[model samples]
Target chain A: MTEKSPGLFGRLKAGLGRTRAKLGGSLATLIVGRKAIDAELIEELEALLLGADIGIEATGVLIGDLESRLSRNALRDGDAVYAALREGMLGILQGGETTLELPSRGKPNLIMLVGVNGAGKTTTAGKLARQLQDQGRSVMLAAADTFRAAAVEQLQSWGERNRIPVIAQHSGADPAAVVFDAMSAAAARGLDVVIADTSGRLHTQGNLMAELTKIARVARKADPEAPAECLLVLDAGVGQNGLAQAEQFGQAVGLTGVVLTKLDGTARGGVIFAIRKKLDLPVKYIGVGESIDDLRPFDPEAFVDALLSGEA
Target chain B: MFTGLSERLAESFKKLQGRGLLSEENIQQALRDVRVALLEADVALPVVRQFLEQVKERALGREVVKSLTPDQAFIKIVNDELVALMGGQSEGLNLTGDSPSVVLVAGLQGAGKTTTVGKLARWLMQTQGLRVMLSSGDIYRPAAIEQLRLLAEQVGAGFYQADTGSSPVAIAQAAVEAAQRNQADVLLFDSAGRLHVDDAMMGEIKQLHAVLKPTETLFVVDSMTGQDAANTAKAFDVALPLSGVVLTKMDGDARGGAALSVRQITGKPIKFFGTGEKLDALEVFHPDRIVSRILGMGDVVSLVEKVERTVDHEQAEKLARKVKRGKGFDLDDFRQQIGMLNSMGGLGSMMKMLPGMPNVGAEASAAGAREMRRIEAIINSMTAAERHKPEIIKGSRKRRIASGSGTQVQDVNRLLKQFIQMQKMMKKAGKRGGMAGLMRGMGGKLPPGARF
Candidate 1:
């Protein structure tokens, strides 16, 4: 394996230096001028977005949109460039409304969380459960991740603190069976919501993913629309890797929405732009911390502001 | 079609080949290259802007480093600024808390959470000589408990696991109780990993925090995940009062922006690093070491220390003395050195610490380690006389050594040449001084390879 430098901050610092150098004299000129709709400025703008790793496809759309606006006399000057760029980027990002729709007339809205191994699926599940409880919803957790012995115990601990019920099975038991039991328990007890925590398996592991698909199938069997939201928890720090994961999980079990965990620690917040652009899947929630209330519903305007202004 | 930052910088340097001092135009050019590199490396845009403004202020009118070209001086300034942006120095784990301090491990799945638990366990056990207990609260994956158990065993730490059906909070509570009951010094609870930061996961962690109230909560992250690692760390930080970070898979070919970014973004220090899969492969993160590595300088001091510990000093001295006397340095000495190198963790890694040595590509570096085994094979093929006096054996002896070693004649010839070179060096060193002088010489040769 390649020995990458271990610190994200240092690499980013170096990365920034490179990005600045790439901007060249034109960036300064563009920044100083208030109104300038020149070809050179457009070229510099294109380089800037591409440098952000917005991916070529998204970059093309952003640049093309800006070019058309400029040609139509809709955009001019540095202020306009900033506004146009921000508006265009936000427009693409805001295409899909990022609200986690709660199911109406349900004792407990079941959200079946799924993702590949190491995708932060279980933590997202726990955080989501906590966030729901914090929102005044009585929540129950199900440790359906029976493949790992500690997984059930971990979820149970989360359940105990939240004062919620967590239905779990013995290690090595069928995960689908555990979720089935949990869902039944949630529905019977008139729980406000039941969050089923599943095992983290590799998306490429067909058998494992197939097993998850079966669990989803079994979950729907219990309540045809029980899993009100199958939130696929992805690490925002994963860059393009996370995008690939989103695509794979979307293919395997159609993702209702995405939960991007760890937004506070990465520079590739641009992955949000890519996910929005490519998958068109709405980001339902994001994890900013390891607290019960850390998971917040995705707000596009807020996110775009954070991306453009670095304030979240 | 697009140029990477490193390539672009190389091209720009060619344009300013004869410049004495950095003109505003050239600095702008260099900054452009730096900006592109940063963006490509997945740095946050705001951070990039802030950093560039600072660099521009510092770099605009400075004299270049003495005897260096304008490009080299610019590179130096950028490297220094890069180092400064990353908090300047590496921070370590805070074990200054009260005894039996709790350390919470937090991160997404596949971030090596369970494995980090083991690595930390071993580190505390061996380094601090503290009694460590590893408890898996990861009651999500079926084998999660077993994984921690296996890791605990590997690290020689006590393992705690509740039945798979048990509640994690109850299990955590019980494990803390168990740690106290067992008189364990440190209790490490490996929590369940998740795919995203959802309300449910946060609630669980919050609940766990209220119960355990760990002294140190370290968010484990994969450096390969880059910006995602930082984002997850931030989420965890807000959710739980994280004390530090443990970045895993530093051995992977990640660009390593996550390590630097997470701390700056989350205001947490990185305490430990998971360098490889082995239980002993964990390292205490030091910022200077990392910066040096990034600058392509080898970290020789650490390398030599490692060698000293692994190699038998007296035996090496004896071998050096023998070689100095023009005595036959045969298969026995070669075998011993090979054994020592192996104990010191492979020759390829040792070489990697030498400054200015080409990266030897991953494939070649791996093959280099295997080459030692071939050298050992050739030595093993030698007869007693051949082992003692390699000169006595001619072409027939080479053939015999090859056949006995299960290698070709070329292998024997290569070994002979290497052995002769070593002997010649030893003889020259002996004429000047002794093994001490040779070690000193080796030290001088070590820095370039070991700077980072």
Candidate 2:
């Protein structure tokens, strides 16, 4: 979207400015003029990681790993400690494969975008459509979010901008019915990918949770293995509550991956590690900006570098 | 979700209770729990660290009171700190400007900036009796302008139209000029937001601020953003002179890091809270009440305020007189109470504002709403004779009512049970201290199985 998109690392660094300012800046101040990793240093570092919205479980694991490494004399200095922290972050984030494996030909890759209200589910779906379209893949978008008054229009605007076909019905229509029609259309038209936009409902809403299950069930009717990727688009700004959403949404619709959005905003993006460590779901994409090109594949190394390179 | 911090703090205090003296080790352990509580609430890590340092300084070496336990004393100290950290009192809008006073709203994309603009406009018009003008400078998004225009029309505010063709600065300038021409009391500028904080977005907003020089620059942020809300508010504060913040979607399940940290981090008061998606769901931010709310202390003041706004005094007085006369509270009375609760944002929100009821989540609130609707439906299916005298409605009548209400017979039965329980409670109230006793009892506990 710029004259030329910045390299992944550069964009990542810029994308994580706020978080880096919070973590990297604090870490630098904490370790300044420090000769060794002492109890006080470890305590400060632990506070920093926990503060970044990294789950207590993930932070505990990282701290435990760091402490054991320190006890073994592997972590001697601040530099080693910083490296160890990076490695610890990567360890939690690196499990799932980053690449979204497309299914073999004959059936379209149906990616269902779901998350709680105001998590940018529709926007992420649009940008994803553009990302796939840029890859020379024919994409169709399903405006299945009939709950919000503006959701359908928002998705349609994205479809129109990207010049992708959008399957939509009237507002307040059954979202499951809309998804069913979109899948049928995608299959009929021989589209390479079908991105479905679900209505943003709080994970706590039971009826809405049931509606999501119904949507997934309806998608299966169109194709036996429909909704190949039920990507949960989580707002990185969400705190411990992200864990609850991930658990509940995972149980309801079966999340395959996560698309962490608003990373460019105030969200520290630390919740990705929690989502990974807890749910075993790889963050398929990270939205860094409003543009289509801002959606970058999640690279654990790049993310850590961005998050820790504030002093640099 | 915001209750997580209070709940976690409560757990820590529970451990400290029955302790002989507050030793250094015990204090440090308690501080660690408090740090985690702040962090889990999405308070910025640095803010959490500094907050703990202050709390530790104030809490340590303090003499224990005769009556209160060390844990209670520590909690009281923490509660005081929480209130101070959030601006100790509500700072309202600066409306001292001449006609066409301007209020500029800014925030990240999907942070409910536009909706807050509409709600603020409606609030200004209805509550403050000011003619408000609304305009959107969010040119990048395809329907951003249209969305604000629709919102303005819905709220009956003066709309200043701007298209994507114009620059954000130009849009702000035009909106101000139009507001002057329309003789509007206040002009609200809704600026565009990028998905991330970028130079282009901030630069444009800063330029708009310079041009408009609005009286109030409120950062509209999603409360769901947790700690990021404070950080993002800080970012905008650096760009523009932010006077206050609007914490949107407080009705949602957010850990409330933003509400807790925004004032401390940015040194700006949270002006209002966007409780729901509806236009009228905005509430004035009360720091002490919010601190109390966060501490699992019900905001009785706010509840009373809401009651004053929603309840019909004449009808309430009539009901009170009937109850005082011991005429008995019936199904019709229960239906009216349920309707009143629904108007006051339902049982769930009411339950949330109540103290010692932190576990009543969105799911429970929604279930309560569903139950209320069912009861209302069943009551609607009842004859006027049956409503006045429940004794006449036999098993055959219950079956007919259930069918008419599209509910199972058991649902009607459950409603009857709930109604009977409420009737007994009302009778007890009438026999004792009357309305004051009923009001006091309402604050103590919610009956486990009663739906209405």
Candidate 3:
């Protein structure tokens, strides 16, 4: 339901050349010479899926479905097998919410970005804020990530670059208080959205996670529906542990959705399938690289095709 | 380290364990289990295949030890192959050159390069007792240099500020000169995080590398990076003569399968692990420990080593002696004990090392740490009289201490009860022997107060 540039598939295909060789291109080889979906072809498909980091559990489910179909004499060729695989992934990825539903009140939609360390929460915060602003939402930035050194300045710089208002405190200030203050100020200023960039914390840190839930709770005092959207910012390159990250963050802050970043390289961002299988959160956005232009709404069709980009 | 349902792997190897030598069919079944384990652990598919092939070659028709099961013998072989691939033991920085040895830290964006740079500075300053300087060649990322400056200040290291708008090469040159002028023993140059596929950025790093001629070009990679870690590690190694890899964010739930991917691809030792957020949270990379972890077989040797390294033996002995002399264990001593627990990388770092450690995510350890911090805070709020003689902590004193510590009266009461148990346990352990006996006996099982 968001902007879809035509360059996405082409860019993703070019950037994901290595992954094509690892997953799609090799599978292309398997398909071109194959007579039918045999055991060896099925095995190669299994390896390709696993190689893409779609993870073992989801891969197992997909493979089991294929085997069951084969046993039932479905008589599927290699193309049918590939389409079935794509459809299976799309079954998991197709319907996730690409946008948040803001409340009717004039209160700002507080989108709190949370995730484990180095998942690019702060960077994604800036890009998402800019994207929302570009979409006619009067966006403001909040720097609640006071723990990391110079984190406030990072968000502040992003705001300065965008010519947007940023609410922040000195390093080591209580993050919840900063989040609340930013929310209330945004509401007072009648901003459409206030994106709060939270400090990256390991989901394993229970007390810190509790602090996040606290932040989510106290923001309601600023605006009744504050923190309307809590997005878990995840790195596309993260492995199977992305599931744990999504689960813990969702449990702690009740994340409304997830945003996968750093999709510019060979990392296929396949962990989202596993994550969606476990925790049924929608994919809100996907970031290609550090640039602001790289952030866009998640398009499952484009993503699935991008993975299998090279085909006759 | 392994996912649930991975109990022993012995059930699948029934025939292998029954006969001392494993049959090919049985070995294939066990290898299937191991293969699934590695895949679930998130090792790259190709790397997993390579690793399984080696394990198969070693485990095929291999005789098991009399005391060991077939699965255990096979796992031992798998663990050895992983360990040997990673490098046999802990490796430190190769800073054997003259003064102001340079180390360039590079990695993908958000892989914790800047934070690891801070931790590395603190590690160099403290462990080696060397004067260190920090500089950031990360001009592209906003506030990156400021982050390094703040970190340098936090770790008590000299910071070399590059001129405004200077290129990375100029920054490296200036940083080296400043280090020479300051007579700093080592200069850690933190570069901007760049994807290996970014040719321009890679080229820029190559130029910076030429300028620095770093004694160590450590690739700081996220432990959670999956199959892409191999491609990126190989690309970076090709772009630069990477001396080693520094796996960052190890304190998280990531199974660290990227450790194998990076090591196998780069053929470089992983030098350090940036364990936690703290500047002193860096740990020397231990291969056997990581191998056991990846293989889902925990060994107590590394745990004991960690305990020995972090635990203050002198303070622990003094506390025991005081308890023996009829001086009761006070709140202050309890606080010190909690501090010791924190210094030992908190509960999760230690918990993951125990053999047969159930899939206790870092949350359990974090909860224990939270409870310990609460106890410490409560003790801090207590009056000296109440702390020294907790018996005098009546209802009013309990309320006052609870309010001061921002805790409820019931929390205070629970702390007091758990403290009493700990006190009794300490007394019994004290009479039994020295701190070593108490540590070994009580270390695995933390005091009730610490366990929430």
Candidate 4:
């Protein structure tokens, strides 16, 4: 929304600057030494993928493909292997539905954010609300996370900063009731969108999952066809467990997409590849910084470029 | 569900059954499986490679123990190396020398820093009998200070916080003065969770560290964190002198590679682990227990320790005597039994430590706990006679008891049904000497506090 700033590709490239340095350092050593691309270079590539939170299965697949190509003499140098690895990663991400389609500016489009604790659901909600509001949509936030201490206040603070209204209940109130109230209020006020920030919970928590399903159900009671999209806020630093989180949350609430968080850090969040392989849910947006302005629509092309090239 | 590594290793190692001794060639197949398991557990590739090297050397040329399989011998070697690498004995906080020792808690955002502070306060008070004071320097996160204040209130610890808009150093300075004035033995300062890559935030924490001169700067980390845990912990260690670590979210199904990675990178003892969300759920880190878990051997030691620490010896003795007299397991005793699990970080945590036990998910076990509390409430509403003999409660009595407990009449019936089943199980177990017999099976591993 800040047109004066660097474009999405440049911003994400900058956010992922460290991944490029690390990967490029290893890749550079392999490519610059001008040695025959051997098993050692491939081993380093495998390590790079694994370090980026790409699961062993996918890393093995990529490495396996590289090894097979090596046998066939398909890859001549480290440069070919690098391009092949980038294309393979892009293959896992590019074909998925990458964007959220908004309903033409009329009824409220409810989006419920869900994830494990500390995945930045609240911060993403603030950023998303501001992004939508800046794009000419009236956004209201639903502080449905009544469980965590001060979660309501956190959302309210975001509302204050964005000059938006956030519907909240007492700290210990039922989160479903809070969502229902927000949806009803948004309908009354003719808001264009409602962003509900739910409490962070482990997907293995059956009661919490049931509570999320109930929230989605309650939103329908307030406004039919509510919660049009449920986004799982996954931390990029998560390893194989991200698969379980995605699977369980998808089964519990029927996740339409994912919002990968904390990508600004050293983590590449490559677990999204496995998540995509399992559920085919798009990585809609990413959180690149603590500032609200850092949320950007995910671009797989730029992300892959930064991850492999470290330069735009 | 991630199957225990032992079961899978046992399967693959079955091929090497005829081999009486493990040689470099024979253990190569086993080592590959182990490498994969370690990697799947989120252990960093570099750490995994180094660990495999150590495992290979120790596993090679070792005779299988009498009556123990070659796989068991190999697993023992790997487990021991892991424990040794992680610092074998349990390490306590360095709270000596000063009257008001400050323990500064820092970590990544949402890594449970404030919650760990609350748990640490309770742990210090319970173990060391120290009068602890809690303070929050987390000015960035909304209502973060209030969160710590509430936790302090819950734990009976004095709370301190600076005015809004004050920098972290100012809050630490003010809290230090307050702790001295209050004569608090320990001042637990909780800082805002920040990323190690964020230089500005890192600088702020470094500034706070300079101002407080904390006796212990514990780095709190989530157990579910991945390979980057090493880098993050290394960065933090480079920025501050991290005395130890507190790994949180152990209650989840994370493989806990972060624990190994953090220890490998920082070379610091993991002082405690946040087992559950409860204040009393913090546990002292045992290398053997975590290594057992990492190797998929189930942490029976920690489970027994949990039972020993949380189980009230007196209550168990009374129940044992009552059972020995054939007085029958009553509703009151059943309620006590339910409360025990609820107190000991829920049945979910217990399930995780038992080998071959199905992890019925934290949510399901949490639901089980809720059911226990409801049943306890129903028992509390009953009169002494009704508790002693649940059969005496007629239809109207059931209705009255249900309403008194804020539950439905059907809920009362459900409790009655469940209690009958539990009573039968308790009677069967009681005939084997009850709690005394259970601990008797533990040999001398039982803690001193646990008495027959």
| Retained true contacts (fraction), each candidate | 0.27, 0.46, 0.70, 0.54
- Cα lDDT for residue B181, model 1? 82
lDDT of model 4 at position A290: 69
- Calculate the i-RMS of every candidate, to one decimal place: 11.1, 3.5, 5.5, 4.8
Off by over 4 Å in 1: A1-312, B1-18, B36-46, B61-76, B88-91, B96-99, B312-318, B321-326, B338-348, B358-381, B399-415, B431-452
DockQ of 3: 0.48
The clash count for each model shown is: 131, 2, 0, 1
Query: What DockQ, between 0 and 1, does each candidate earn?
Result: 0.13, 0.38, 0.48, 0.40
Q: Candidate 3, which segments miss by more than 4 Å at Cα? A: A1-10, A13-24, A310-312, B1-21, B61-69, B293-315, B322-349, B355-428, B440-452
TM-score quality measure for candidate 2: 0.86
Chain A of candidate 3: what's the TM-score?
A: 0.90
Pairwise lDDT winner, candidates 2 and 4: 4
TM-score of chain B of each: 0.83, 0.88, 0.79, 0.76
lDDT of 2 by residue, B45-118 (tens): 76777788878877775544443677777888788888888875776799876778889888877778888888
Candidates ranked by TM-score:
3, 2, 4, 1
Greater TM-score among 1 and 4 belongs to 4
Error of 1 at B429 (Å): 2.7
| Structural similarity to truth (TM-score) of each candidate | 0.60, 0.86, 0.87, 0.84
lDDT of each: 0.67, 0.77, 0.79, 0.78
